[model samples]
Target: MKRLKQIVNELKLTQAAPEAALMREFIFYSPKMPLRLHQEQLVAASKQFSLEVFDTYFAHSDVTINCFSWGNGKRKVLLAHGWASKALDFYELIIELLKIDDLEIIAFDAPGNGSSISEFSNLMLYAGSVKSIALNYAQPDVLIGHSLGGMANVIALQELEITPHLLISIAPLIRLKENFEQSLDSVNIGAKHQDLFFDNFAKEFPVSASHFNLTNLYQLSTAIDHFLAFDPADHISPYSFLKEFLDKYPAIKSKSFEDVGHYKILRSLEVIDDVVKRIYALPML
Candidate 1:
């Protein structure tokens, strides 16, 4: 059964590249199909949290960004969400950090995802979306990001010329190593064939996408949906998104974890607490 699954997955990859991109957009861009999180959980968790969520324009691009703060303070903490995810995705962790009376939390949805704009065509456009958001809320003592968000933050900081006192990245895509980079545009393993990735990993490698739940699958599907509009074939490989974005290399330092796919990396309470401690420990200026 496993061998047969692998064969089927490979065949799908071989056949899907040309049209898979279009099909992906059809699934993701519907106004009725926008991705959402558990609203009650987000709202109930945020009471007395001094939350201010709104949309603002940055460089004329409408950005959906939120600010959560407690008490008056000069310090600002900005949280960036991963690809295809919204600012609310960080609500759970943001609530935890809001307990600190002297701190502020802000998060934003990147372009082409969530309530933000729906049309961005390249890595620079994605990074610029971050820059536009950052300019509106630049009072940062620290910057936190997960996976694609982390990478975008790096690019945004450079583009906006904004610097935070501390930078923390969780499972960031600073580099993809060699094998994953090589596989990006491979005729047999391109990004367009991600629907078959689970089966491919299960049968070809020892990994199974089933280890994750429906939420994870939904987010992955969202990412595929957005990538479809970009016509990834025009670019070298999806790998170049990171390479091109990182060419200048911002000064922030970071730590990464394995075994945690992008979404799981942001869901860690440990990371949230660690970030709070680091921000609080910074010297008052």
Candidate 2:
């Protein structure tokens, strides 16, 4: 990825049209890594307990979202997976949550992700898809999001009028600017294209980088319980980002794990147990 970015950066310096094309490719490309054999087994195991499983399509203005749901409990729990991943990434977590009575579990393949036909998607698109699902299907009592989905959920909360009973974010991407800068730096994109990148990005998305801050949308009056669990060793979504939120929202319950890292943290039995315990710990609402 770094080498590809470096090549794009050089092309940007040399020509205008090719540079724009390269930039578009960088912005729109979605990795298509399929679930591994073990992951497939986990997903298969999870499916065994589902009361009902079916596919549904949601048409948002420009994009069509394809997603699936498991269980039929009155109380809904929505799960959003991260980039380069499908809803099945949460198979283990879903499996554990299924043991809980009166809880419906829904997971979706976002546009440009998983089985969805869309070829590209940004944060705004992901957030919009989330909001559409919440409003059109069921307003989730418990909202669980991992990685990029976690960040999109934060943005979705801003637009969603319904306040969930609990919001659990696992290894969430917190700072947009920091992430963007790191991506640019990784590809050795210099000062000029860095400025150009943000400018072009702002034009493409509905929300600006300045408005993407989750802290601005979070409120104590929202009357929602929040739980954040992140592995301190996680490099993708740094522990420091979660720590920043912890410092700001003292009421937010959090647990830090040692060796879980980013992806494994989702599948960890210990983490799944912790999440289930947290959900059950909450008083009936």
Candidate 3:
């Protein structure tokens, strides 16, 4: 078994460079569906909440938005997804919050996930997408995001003036350390197995094997390629980018989940409920 593992690692190392390049491109393209099983589960959970969905275009990419229009509610809460995840990932939380007729909940599949255009070639592009969405949608009373979504929210909030009453960051990937950068550079899906990269991570991680399945393995591969190409350290620089954001907005309040990894943060029902209650409890502008 150990020998087999060694061989697999060697093979992956052998093809890392080419795969990383390909992965980078995939991130810029959009994601499609039959969708993942987890995605479907979230969608079904959201459906119970009387949420209405809207399809729009931004940066030449298609974007699908799901929102529950709370009657006479001026405040909007925008939920964002993480890397390699679709907007529907928030469906579990949406279902719970939509019960509060006073809270208008809005969530979107980021450019590459679900019904949104997938063209996040860089952080700036992602920030632009978020800005466009916020400007076009109801101004957010609060913005809540998990992992990559949180980073994107910071960028959008910094670049655009659509300030939310509060920000909730769940296991946010604030910055990629230099070590993590090199480690991510190690992921390799050869030409033949490229389609397995994105789906593989879900399977290998905490997600139940029965829960997550890709709609189109090809599209999943494309998404993985795009994500792998990025120098995460450069985009959401902890030293520079985050520092700049904090300097500009010194009092922006945020809550973080320390124990959860990138994706699992949203999978937990408890975490979702806690985040909702916290957001609801915060003082309004």
Candidate 4:
């Protein structure tokens, strides 16, 4: 994937969504390097916890997904990490959650991420993987997600047809259209595929591209104790639109951290403490 991207950039290949579907493939299955900073430490630390790591089949993606468990069955709290991130990325958060008595903490490696390998993946596939993790295995009492995983948690609430105890979104991707634009921009791919994306999006999803956002989460599920944590200066997740969305609907609880950016927010002690408090205060199911 890296070589394909590099070749496109160096050759200045004319970016287009041809009938060949190269553009669509690049847009959805883009590569990720989530473990570069603390790869060994994250895995090593996860091993120390004696996690009950296992695999389950994600039939839609035709992949056997990897999952991690910290405690026995109890008040289930499912964790979903963002794009390119693995289950163990939540190692610190898992440590904090394990302190809560009788809490069954579970997390999974989404397709094309960590141990769950696949050639195809998109927001739909990621969301489907999340739904499979919760509905097919651990039905979550509280759903907590970071980045893309956060958005998937909301999607899971809708698909599972259950009002979750609480949903925590940590710097989630707000708009899929904007997210695609940003991803391409970061790779210097320009906004050349905007038109093609919408055209392709229609075929990929029954609803319009606009439906894949936080705005619709309200209508999809009810009585969800939604909480959000973000950085005002986050470059990965669009902050301007997030602020706009927050302004339009002020009820969703939220907090901003200046010290930590997107990934670092996951490790912030302050953020972890706040999240643990919210977990402890979950509404009775």
Candidate 5:
């Protein structure tokens, strides 16, 4: 991916037509990384608990997206995984959520991730996919999203007409422009290239950088119960971001863990229990 970005940077310097195309490709392309043996085992084990597992496809913008679901319960729960992650990343959560007799679990590999065919996807695409799935495929009574997925869920709630009775975000990415800047800095991309990237990104996404924020969206009035869980040690999606949200929505139930970072938080027993407790505690809607 860094090489691709470097190529895009070189192409941008020339202002060539293919430069835009390559930039788009770089933005959209999500390379599939092989899971470790333990990770594969976790996914395999999670599948065992599924009463049923099936694939479904949906259209987001011009792309067709593939999604997978497990369990068979009247009350539906939609799980959204983070960037470069598959539905199986939420395996631990799926196992715990299944404890609820009437709860079904639906999860999808966002475009460019997992089994989805699209080469690239952005936060807007992720949010649109979530909204499309909720409206057409399954209406979720409970929505749980982790990291980038959590950010997508927040955007979905803001733009979509339907709202889940309960919403849970685990280590959500906030501060859109800042995150983008951080990403560019980490890659050592030049300031000129960063400007070009954001320009292209804005054109493709069609949303102002100012609008791509959870802090701004969370301020809107909503009766849906919100739960946020984060660890201060999370370096990717800083705990400070979560802190900003908590400060604004003090009514939101929250949990802070010291040991777990971004990825492992999904698998932590304490986090799972807290998530389950929130869902089970929700009055049937």
Candidate 6:
């Protein structure tokens, strides 16, 4: 309250205006983690596997994206990193993929994430970046995504020129609108500013709030296998909500682990093994 009032007073702006400004700032970033602290990890991981870095133009902006690739197998596996994370964050997972004789691994950082350059980012921008990366690379035979990256890969299934043979989603965002609203509430903005913020949000995004979720957008062309791995105890992407969402589609194959949290699920050897096995299990397309 004090900081909000101070900003409002200093700028001679209404309380709602400052809250709206804050809402815009938070809405773009609340769901994603920042990667500055992980710089050393990215640097050291880049040294392994003789990574090949390339650039692509993100679909939503005039920004260049950093893409990573390794392995020399005929089958291409594309890895999409979540917001605020880079391609090398999956160093362990990449190591497992490298072991496969027939797999060529590909991964990329979305604009403003990792080595990619951009001033800011949003879900739509990230999704657009995913689409751009898929088309730039040879269409991937296997697609893997984590968190926001998982959601982006799902969106890729809809937007890509060709559908992948296998899709793996790890704790994707179930309903981004609900999460965004909760983020708004956390900032202690009153209802009026919230309304104003959303009104402008709709104008800027030009899409229904309901459209950004995983449920309504989740689909793959026939013959595509899907795997989902997530810890039900995850607080970031709540297990109960994921359960209800999963319950609606019983055919989807899933594995549950407890206490690994949202991000560590990526690092879990069990997850890496199962994911590798599934990729090998995928019928060559």
Using TM-score as the measure, the top candidate is: 2
Which is better, 4 or 6, measured by lDDT?
4
Write candidate 5's Cα lDDT for 71-122 as tens digits: 7777889898888787877877877777787887888777767666664667
What's the lDDT for residue 66 in model 6? 68
lDDT of each: 0.47, 0.72, 0.50, 0.71, 0.73, 0.70
Q: Which stretches of candidate 4 lie over 4 Å from their true place?
A: 1-20, 30-61, 190-192, 206-208, 220-222, 283-285
Q: Which tens-of-lDDT digit does each residue in 1-285 have in candidate 4? A: 584566456424554433325555656553655555554554554422211212222233255566767677478888888876778778778888978887888777777677766664566656776777665677888888998888887776776788677888999988877777665555455454566667667765656667777765545433567889999999888688788767866777889988699999999999999999988776444
The runs of at least 3 residues in candidate 5 whose Cα sits more than 4 Å from the true structure, single-residue gaps closed, are 1-27, 34-61
Displacement of the residue 169 alpha carbon in candidate 3, Å: 1.3
- For model 6, residues 1-285, the per-residue Cα lDDT tens digits are 243344434334444455555566555532334455454454445423222222222234266666666766778888887766777778789878877887778777776676666655666656666676566556788889888888878776687656677888887778777766676565556677777777887776677566776766766654567789999888778887788878877767899978788888899988999999898787664
Candidate 6: 10-residue stretch with minimal lDDT: 49-58
* TM-score quality measure for candidate 4: 0.82
True-vs-predicted CA distance for residue 148, candidate 1, Å: 1.4
Q: Model 3 lDDT vs. the true structure?
A: 0.50
Candidate 4 least-lDDT 10 residues: 47-56
**Candidate 3 global TM-score:** 0.57
Question: Is 3 or 4 the stronger prediction by TM-score?
Answer: 4
For each candidate, what TM-score against the reference?
0.55, 0.82, 0.57, 0.82, 0.81, 0.81
For model 2, the superposed segments whose C-alpha errors exceed 4 Å read 1-18, 36-60, 220-222, 283-285
Clashing pairs in 6: none
Ordered list by lDDT, greatest first: 5, 2, 4, 6, 3, 1
Superposed by TM-score, candidate 4 places the C-alpha of residue 273 at a distance from the truth, in angstroms, of 1.4
